[model samples]
Target: MTELTVKKREAVGKKVKAIRRQEMVPGVLYGQKQKNEPVAVDKSAFEKAFLAAGETGVINLKIEGADKTVPVMIYALDRDPLTDKITHVDFYRVDLSQAVVAEVPLVFIGQSEAVKNEGGILVTSLKSLEMKSLPGNMPKRIEVDIAGLKTFDDVIYISDLTVPKGVEILNEPETAVASVKPPRTEKEIEAAKEGPAEEPAVEEAAVPADEEKNGGQQPAAEGTERPSEEKKADA
Candidate 1:
């Protein structure tokens, strides 16, 4: 478990900006049975703890002046669009005895024979898996072994995944997680390189019926001065 210490925050609204300028991040902690508490943490410290615990791993959050540390998980984050800096965060207090659902990132490991020997492309359909487990039993990430993908026809599905005894995957059992795709043929590769077939050259704009009746000259488009207006301007 990762441990992070934060101070109770008094700043709110525009005053919170001052805390951020001091290299602190403002956040709130809340849960089913817990009171919403505003806190501030050192930006660098929060980053390190987040990297270690992610969203699934349990974190021991200590609040200044509090008697006991609270077990929690990062629930959400807000970032500055231009700088991509963390602006605010939400922490969900967790009960060790209760079960919770969380999405665990999937990490692909091992080489596929189809990709290495048969020139097939490895395609993955899932990037994460939703799982239910006690906070203490939650895994930071799930490893997916791709070595079994021996051919283009071979696929790994949710039902095939192995996890800890207390953890239950919530996704449909038949969902395909990974597979090997047949490599593109030479002709197909060339066509892709040439880009989509030149969109059939837009047929020349059809001559308007009114223009056809008035001879070859196209009528002035709407919003533009007509020949008569131009003649009047010249006069």
Candidate 2:
């Protein structure tokens, strides 16, 4: 668990933008059966704690002037899309004794012989799993071993995952965590490279009625007389 200090914040709405300039990141803390309180923490301190805690593990939030430190988990984080700076955060207070559900990231470890030796593509079907555990028992991340993947047909499933004694995985044991797919054939590779076919070009058969087809001259009217044989006879 990481311990971080924060201060109670009275700033609300538009004032938060100003608070950020002072290197104080504004956030709110709320949870089941917990009071919603606005708080602010030094951006540098918060970043250090967040990196350690991620979102699954518990954090010890010691607010200034508060009597007791609170256990919290990162509920949400908003970031600047372009800058990728942490904009605002939502902290979820958690009861140490009560069980809560969170998604723990799956870290794939070890090289698979199927991929290293054979021409196979490694596929990670599940990147995370839902788990229920007390705040004290929660893990920041889960590790899935891929060393057993010796063949393209082999896979690592949820049943193979190991967790802390108190943690409960809420997914089926048969769920595939990682596997090696057989290498793509030349035909398949070519088809993928070709992409979708181009649309057919428009034909010219639907020309407008006012437009001439054979030439610029319009056809002679049906009843119009033909020109007399003006051709001079051979002399």
Best by TM-score: 1
lDDT of 1 by residue, 1-235 (tens): 7999999999999999999999999999999776899999999999999999898888999999888999999989999999999999999998899999999999999999999999999899999999999999999999999999998899999999899889999999999999999999999999989998766666788888988976867787889976675798998
**What is the alpha-carbon lDDT for the whole of candidate 2?**
0.88
Candidate RMSDs in Å, in order, are 11.1, 7.7
The estimated TM-scores of all candidates read 0.81, 0.81
Best by lDDT: 1
Q: Which lDDT tens digits does candidate 2 get at residues 1-235?
A: 6999999999999989989999988999998776799999999999999998898878999989988988889989999999999989999988888999998999989889998999788999987899999988888899887889999889888998889999999999999889999999999889899998799999867544544653444455679853444633432
lDDT at position 218, candidate 2: 49
